[model samples]
Target: MNPVFKEFKEFVNKGNVIELAVGVVIGGAFGKIVTSLVNDIIMPPIGALDRTDLSGLFISLNGTFYQTIKQAKDAGAPTLNYGLFLNSILDFLIVSASIFLLTRAFIRFQKRQVEAENADKICPYCISKISINAIRCPQCTSILEETH
Candidate 1:
């Protein structure tokens, strides 16, 4: 095998690369779910409240008036589709908020896992983390008394 091909094989076989590939697949699926939620579930009530179908909202640039985007397109008028833009903005906000919440939860979970694994003690003098069995604070070089 060529040296470059061998190197590429090694790189592709790495755990991080495989994990990233899985993440990409999951992210794509998650994107579809978010898009559906925005279009079907979230937008309907908003459109009802606004008394306007968001997808049909547009402004004609040719000074020709049209009731909806489809009408404007049918009439061969240039339009600014602000309603569709609004929907896209909503989708982005929803996806961003979901990712933020998930990342925050994951961080909290990781912190708990780390704390559980360490089972260490904090030095009273220096407030530094040390082994639970340590009799002295390594950071401050202070003697530690055993607490019953």
Candidate 2:
């Protein structure tokens, strides 16, 4: 039991685990934000321009008119809520785009870090700062191992 508890604590304390938990929470909040953006901000203007509320674009299997989607679902009506689906699709696209852009930025930052780290350094043989130069080291009689 103590070992199990210790293992659990270690698992929770791990950087990846903590990051994953934070990501999940942030992702949930981001999902809600995207949903609101799609429903309230983006879709509203589009709906206004198209002359139709997305919520109203539902077909009932039975002959029943619903003011809202919640009411339609509550009344046990089979509805084809294509407009809501479109809104959801837009939300997904926005989220996907945001994630893609973030990942791309992260990758670019990592590449920059790597390039900075792997930049010109002093040659071990020559003791001179060189940008991957010196096939034969200038100061010493050693051939550079970097060159074939």
Q: Give the alpha-carbon lDDT of every model.
A: 0.88, 0.82
Give the least accurate 10-residue stretch of model 2, judged by summed lDDT: 139-148
lDDT by residue (1-148, candidate 2, tens digit) is: 6999999998887759878888999999999998988888888898889789875677776789887777889999988898778777889899999999999999999999999767766678658766665566565656677742
TM-scores of all candidate predictions against the true structure: 0.75, 0.73
Q: Clashes in model 1: which pairs? A: none
Candidate 1 lDDT at 90 equals 86
With a 3 Å backbone cut-off (N, CA, C), the pairs that clash in candidate 2 are none
Tens-digit lDDT string for candidate 1 (94-144): 989999999999999999999876878888989998888889888998999
| Leading candidate by TM-score | 1
